[model samples]
Target: MIIPDAESIAQARSIVLAALSEAHAKHAGRGFDPYEFGADVSPLVNAYAALTILEKEEPSELAEESSPED
Candidate 1:
């Protein structure tokens, strides 16, 4: 898979936060309290952090050699 750049990463974060916010709003309207469930969202947070780390690391030589010239 092609690793995303900084801007792409930011856009993804925005999208994820927006989706989460929307879901929260929907549930709140139905009297859902997140604190009551004590649900941990760490998995999703950790996955996103891992993606950032992958983006920061140098691209694989194979990826570099295979990508078309700009």
Candidate 2:
């Protein structure tokens, strides 16, 4: 299994956040596409939720990697 580097993880989060923001805009526009929301957005929402839970439960462990090493 391959581990993700910091840049990789950050890029992933950025992508997910951008997608979710677009979804939110779609939601605000009163246009909901079930197929697109399900096929495209569901997994990203789940992933972001999971990451949030992890951050809450293991803040230190997650933050450790972001710290500079000497």
Question: Which candidate gets the maximum lDDT versus the true structure?
Answer: 2
lDDT of each: 0.65, 0.70
RMSD of 2: 7.5
Q: What tens-digit string does per-residue lDDT give for candidate 2 at 28-67?
A: 5887777766777788888887655554544466567567
Write candidate 1's Cα lDDT for 1-70 as tens digits.
Answer: 6656768877877776666576667767788877642253444466567756756766675378568897
Q: Poorest 10 consecutive residues of model 1 by lDDT?
A: 36-45
Q: Whole-model lDDT, candidate 1?
A: 0.65
Top-TM-score structure, candidate number? 1
TM-score for each candidate, following the candidate numbering: 0.53, 0.52
